[model samples]
Target: MFGKTFAGSPRRQRFLGNRREVQPRLEAAKMMDRLTLLPAELLDPKYGVMSSPLLPTLASKFSNLLVDPWESQAALSVLLAYYGLSCVSTIGLRQEPTFGNEKLITTPIAFDFSHNDHRMAQYLMWGHVLKAVDALVDLLQQLDYLGDPALGKMWDRSLIYVATDFGRDKTRPAKAESWGTGHSLNNGTLIVSPLLKGNRVFGGIEPTTCETYGFDGSTGDSTPGLNCSEGHIYSAIAQALDIEFPERIDMSALLA
Candidate 1:
């Protein structure tokens, strides 16, 4: 581990002259609750850029770090998997740590654009989301977690859902260099999982007005004429996982 106990603290310097910190304090805080628990090798981009003699050592140390209880164990578990290490302990459990059987793990990525400055930096925000998801997909593929090979299945039940607070306004400045958008009623969620009925979008977007329309979940047909609620989205996810809920939703179109 990086040898710190709290978040937001500077990582231990790796080299004498390389004063440039490897990880940003803010970004590190967002990823791990305890910055000190991170392995020093990860802080140096060079470790991952090229084969190093220290990879085994770094991986071993990282595996040890996962043994301790932490707030961001779910994220750490993914990180460990990225490094081809096993996360034996329960994620986010502090006391009486034991092997976990949890099939679902959730982590927060700070993609909110509440500040005005973020309005002009949409690309950066999107880039972060893309990079994070790409890394996860790559790791999952490497681990062969996409499907059960024994069953001849193409996909596993694992899923990643990216939900946002709200949607941006349809309107934009006609000729402004830096335009800002406002919060709107419309928004969409991104669901990534091989178990899903892929390559299909349930909602319809109006070209002239840039508005989103509802869809029929049962038939995967555009239902612009009907209105849907947030509960419908929740129901779709539940249906995909084969979990029973009291809420009624026609998620037949959204599930596999």
Candidate 2:
């Protein structure tokens, strides 16, 4: 949900979990409370305060700490769930191993590239996207995350997959940019993963009509009349993640 509003702007992501205020403080303490094993009924899914199930137990204990409430059952459920986590973690639960410690975090990034396709003609659409990618790569390099064995970094373990709803229409003659275009099925996904054969395009764009052509899944060769779907890419990802299915496209050629 966090991203820079403009191209090349100095803004950054918001990480207000540790703030003294209510929301941030509670948000920061959520995981810790669970780790410490708080004894609250609301933490259980059957009696959760804000969920289809009781996702947190300590809600009953802390709800009274806050005054704002539209219903009698509100404060007790919320505060206990929020405050209990913080108190437990700070009291001596959030700790790292003596010699071995590792963490794996994942998040998704979204772009405003829906019907606002008019920005494509102005170069603004790709501008911010490219800049954001550049910044991410820079950070990865600084942290030695891009396959740096000498520094003991994870090395190619991280993957960045850029998805699109669909492609824009090819109505505009080959190279002529247009104001807007309808969605088309001729689109491709951009993936940055060590588990794939990098720097390769499984499909090619036809220059005459500016259309995309799929490739041969077996040989990874461009096939003009061929067609592929998002499911094919999903199969490739599954291969990389060591997942299995009874039926899937033969996309082994894309994997590393």
Best by TM-score: 1
Report the C-alpha lDDT of model 1 over 32-131, residue by residue, as the tens digit: 4322345454466643333322234334433323432332343455544433344232332222223324421111233343453453335545654455
Model 1 ranges off by over 4 Å = 1-37, 40-74, 77-120, 144-155, 172-180
Give each model a TM-score.
0.53, 0.47
Residue-by-residue lDDT tens digits, candidate 2, 149-204:
46543224444565666676776656766545677888888877777898888888
Local distance difference test, each candidate: 0.53, 0.49
Model 1: lDDT of residue 41? 49
Misplaced by over 4 Å in model 2 are 1-122, 137-152, 172-180
How good is model 1 by TM-score?
0.53
Question: What local lDDT score does residue 11 receive in model 1, on the 0 to 100 scale?
Answer: 41
